[model samples]
Target: MSFRTGKDFEFDPINGTNIIAREIGFKQTTFYNSTLTGTHKIDALGGFTVNWYGSFGILDQYIPLLQRLQYNQYTNLPGSPYLALISNGLSQKSGSVFYSTLSDYLYNAGGDISKSFTLFGQNKR
Candidate 1:
């Protein structure tokens, strides 16, 4: 325990924390017939994803021997030690919290067409 003065020392000890999480997504496509004169081709893709996170924690110290310095009612009460700075119970309860989320999607489409023509000599196609 650490000392804060002639009449005060480290007493209240507590811990707090939080957490989070998420999800993923994917997509793909294919096609046939690659040429206008011979055949045609096409492809596409689409998908969506989701994710979220949340966390919380708290610490509380409740001891009858411990005292709060803010209250004068215990100052001149005889055996009641003079506490300089402290909490009475719920007033000293400490905690933390966090929350987050993510959701989105992507889509794409593509196609192709082609043809061959004869030029001058030797079967150029």
Candidate 2:
């Protein structure tokens, strides 16, 4: 979703009346996550009993631009600088916020083997 409105003065008063300056929202946002795991087991050379497992995973996200501006709650103003006018057009569709970006990756590997012999009540290894 996208909604853009013109007129951005957005508060620039330390004590000199406004000259016009604004900076809003995000310029860059980034994240990355990765994982890996493994397990293996082996027993008996002639009887043969073995188990194994493996896994891998990854995720990534990045945001380049998100622009929004609004200002109304700052007290203290004197007069010194003046030059403020904004015009580009107007927009209306107020409900706000809907932007997303995502990327993901995964990998897998596996192995297992087993062998056993039994009769009544006798087990020794």
Candidate 3:
């Protein structure tokens, strides 16, 4: 299992704009294995095996509105005149969190036995 997170912050004194971002996530994995066998002269040979695995994780991002756009001579102006540019900037900051999980397992079992006897020439059972 593991956990991680990150954060960033910036300030523009001239434009009086501040940018902040943070992220956090975690991950976990599990595994299992087992085997069984029998040893006997008269008995058949038998064995079994199993394997299991699992994992999970999550991630998220956050951005302040002011940090979405580059504060400059053109972007600094607040009005519908730069609607396209401003909307683009907002889109950049718009982000969503994500999560994922996966789990699976495998199992196998088998057995075999052989015996030799004299019938006509040779026989096996």
- Name the candidate that leads on TM-score: 3
| Candidate 2: stretches off by over 4 Å | 3-44, 68-115, 119-125
lDDT of 3 at 27: 48
The order of the candidates by lDDT, greatest first, is 2, 3, 1
lDDT of 1 by residue, 1-125 (tens): 21222211123123211111111222222222222222323232222222222333232322223322231223224556533333334542112122223222223333343333357754332
For candidate 1, the 10 contiguous residues with the lowest summed lDDT are 16-25
lDDT of 3 by residue, 46-119 (tens): 42223333333333333222222222223255542322123323244333334555555555666555555668
Alpha-carbon RMSD of each model:
20.3, 11.7, 12.5
Query: Which prediction has more favorable TM-score, 2 or 3?
Result: 3
Cand. 1 Cα-lDDT: 0.28
Instruction: List the pairs of residues colliding in candidate 2.
Output: none
Give per-model TM-scores. 0.20, 0.27, 0.31
Candidate 3 local distance difference test against the native:
0.38
